[model samples]
Target: MTDPSDAVEADRALKDKHRTMWALGDYPALASRLIPELGTVLVRACGVKGGQRVLDIAAGSGNASIPAAQAGAHVVASDLTPELMETGRRLAGEAGVDLEWREADAEALPFGDGVFDIVMSCLGVMFAPHHQAAADELVRVCRPGGTIGLINWTPQGFVGQMFATMKPFMPPPPPGVQPPPLWGTEAHVRELLGDRVTDVEARTRMLRVDRFARPEEFREFFKACYGPTVAVYQHIADRPEQVADLDAELAALADRNLRDGGMDWEYLLLTARRAGQAATGPE
Candidate 1:
C-alpha cells in the first residue's frame, strides 16, 4: 500500500500547480468579469466601513482584499501563496489602491492583539486543517467588539451535488484515508468556532458561477482547475479517450446552464459575526 503522506503531498503539489496555472491570466479583471460586484458584496457583508483596519486572510487573487481597499478601508491582505499575492498586488496597483499584502497562514497569523476592526475571510477558513486554531486566530487579532466576517460554502446545493458526481472520477485514497471533513456546513463551522464568539450569523448566499463558457471552455477550465483528478485518469484509465468522454458527460450534465454563455455554478456564501455581548448566548 502506498504511504498516506505521499498521497497528501502529491495532491497538495497538484493543487499548487493548478493554482499557478490559474494565476497566469489577468486575475483582477478575470475576477471582476466572472463575479460582477463580488468584492463589493463581500466588503459590505464584512461590515467594512471606510477607514477601518481590515485583515483579509487567505486573500486569494484579491477576491476580498481589493474590494475592501476600494471601499476606503485600510486593508491588510495575507495569503499562503506568494504567487497569488503577487497577482493581488498587481491587480490592486492597477486599480490605484495601496494594500499591504503579506504571506501568512490562517492557523498562524502575524498580527498584534485587538488591532483590526474587522477580520474577514472568504472561502478560506473552510480549507484549514486546524479550523479551530484558525478561528481562534481570527478572534485573537480582532479588538473587543470587532466583527469577524466569513464566507464559506454550505454543505447543500449545487456545488455539493457536483462534488458527489465527481467523486467517481477521483482517485481512491489508501486505507485509513482520514480526509478532512467538509468545513462549510453551518453546524460544522459553529463547532469549529466554539463558544467564544457571539452574534454568529451563518447564512448562505446563492452565487451563480460560470464554470465555463462552452464545451471547449469546459475542457480548458477542467484541465486548468482540476489537478490530480485528471492526472489520476491519465494513469489508471484503460483508454485515455475515456477522459474526453467523461468531460463530455459532465458538460451534458450541466447542459441547461451551459447552453448559453457559460455554465451556471451555484456557490454558497456564508457570513458570521463576532459577538460583543455575553459569550454564553447564541452565536
Candidate 2:
C-alpha cells in the first residue's frame, strides 16, 4: 500500500503538473470553447455587483476571476498552487483587469469573518482533501446575506460516464482505496454545505469538448490534462505501449460521435446563498 502522505503529495504534485502546463498557455487555447462560456456563466451566477468584494477560491488561470473583475467587482483570487495564481495575475493584467492574487489553502482560508460579499469556486471545492471543511470556510468569510456559489460536475453525468468507461484500463491502488471527494454530485454538495446556505440552486449544461480532432491529440490532451488517470492507465495496461493503444481506442470512440465539429460533454453548475444570519465558524 502507498503511504497516505505520499498519496497526498502525489495529488498536489499532479495538480501542480497541470498548473505548470496550464501556465504554458495551452489550456486556454484548447479549452477555449467551454472555459470562457463556463466562466461567464459562473460569474453571472455570482451576480457581481459593482464594488462588491469577491473571493475566487481556486482561481485557476483567472477563468472566473477576470469575468468577475470585468463586471466591476473587487476580486481576490486565491489558489493552492502559486504557479496558477501567478498565471492568473498575468492573464488578468493582459485583459486590463486588476485583481489581487493570493496563495492560500481552500480548507483554511486566510481571510477574516465577513470579508467578502461573495465567495465562489469554479470546479474548485471538489478537490479539497476535506471538502466539508473547505465549504465551512467559504461560509465563514462570507458576510451575512452573502452568496457562496460553487460550480462542479455531477456524478453519473456524461463526463462521469466517460471516466467509468476508461476506468477498466487504468491502474489500481493497493485495495479498498477511495479517491478524493470532488463535487461531482448534487447530494454531496448539499451535504457539504449543510444548513449554512439558505438558498441552493443547481443547473446542468452540456459543455462542448473539441480541439482533439486526431487520436494523437487526444493522447496528449488526456495524458497532460488527466495525469493521475494516465498513471493508472500505465499501471493497469501492463505496459507503456498498451496505454497508447487505450488512447487510440478512446479517440476512435470520440470520433465516431462527433457532431457539429465537437464532442459534447455534460457538466453541472451549482450555486448556493449563505443565510442572512450571522456567519458560522468552520465545522
Candidate 3:
C-alpha cells in the first residue's frame, strides 16, 4: 500500500519542479512586452468593476490583477511562483496601484469558499498538473452568481502547435497530467466545469503575435524568455541532436504560421457564472 505521506511528498516534489520551471525564464518581461494584453480582454469580458473582490489565479506578473485593480476592483493576484508575484508587485507599485500578491497553488487556492466576486486566469491555471482540481478551485472560491473568466491558447493555435513540436524533445509529464491546451477547447472546459456553472459563453479570439520577423526569431525568443520552452531546451541540454531538432521544428512552426503582418494566436475566452450559492454552504 502507498503511504499517504509518500504521496504527499511526491505531490510537493512535482510542484517544486513546476515552480522551478516557470521561475527559469524571464516571464514577467515576456508577458509585458511579447505577450498580448490578455488580462485586459478577460477583465473586460468578466466586467470587473470597482468595489468587486477579484482573484487572479496563477496570475503571472499581475497581467490580469493589475488591470482589475486599475478598474477599481479589489484584486488579489496569486501564483505558485513568488518570483513572478514579486515582479507584479513592482509593476503595480510603479503604476501607483496596489494588489494583494499571494503565493498560492491553483489546485488548492488559499482562499475561502465563495470569497471572490470574480475569479480569472489569463493564459494561466491551464498549466496546473491537475485540471479537475484547478477547475474546482476556480468554482469553489467564486461566490454564487459571480463570474469566472479565462483566456487560454486553443489546441489548434500557434502556441499549441509549438508545444506539439517540442513534445518529441521533452520528457513525459507526470501521471494524470493533461496537456495545458485542453483548457482552451470549449468542450473540454465544459466537461471540466460540469453543471457547477451557468450562462456558459465561449469565444475564439485572435491575438496578433508578430513579435518575431522570422521563424528562427520565434524559437530564439521563446528559448530565452519563455519558461516552458526554456525548460524543455534545458531538459535536453545534453542531447545536441534533440536540441537541434527542436530548434528546427520550432522555427518551422512559426514560419508557416506567420501571415501577412504577423501570426494570429487563437485563444478561447470563456466566462461563466458559478451556480447559485450552495443550498447550505460549501461542503
User: Per-residue lDDT of 1-283 in model 3, one digit per residue for the tens?
Assistant: 9899988898999999999999998999889876648889899999999988999999989989998999999999999999998899999999889889899999999899999889999998999999999999999999998899999999899888888888888788878889999999999999999999999999998899867788888888889989999999998999899888888888888889988858999899999999985334321
* TM-score versus the correct structure, for each prediction: 0.74, 0.78, 0.96
lDDT of 1 by residue, 140-171 (tens): 88776677777764445444554454567666
Tens-digit per-residue lDDT, 1-283, candidate 2: 8699997777666555544433453444433444677778888887887788999997777888899999999999988767566667778889999989988778778999888988998766665655667778998898887888777766655456556656677545333233332476767778877887877887777777677666466656765655344555646566767676667666776666566767666666777777776454321
- Pairs in clash, predicted candidate 1: 198-275
Q: What are the lDDT scores of the predictions, listed in order?
A: 0.66, 0.71, 0.90
Which ranges of candidate 1 are over 4 A from the true structure?
Answer: 1-30, 171-181, 210-216, 225-242, 256-264, 276-283
| lDDT sort, best first | 3, 2, 1
Residue pairs clashing in model 2 are 155-184, 171-232
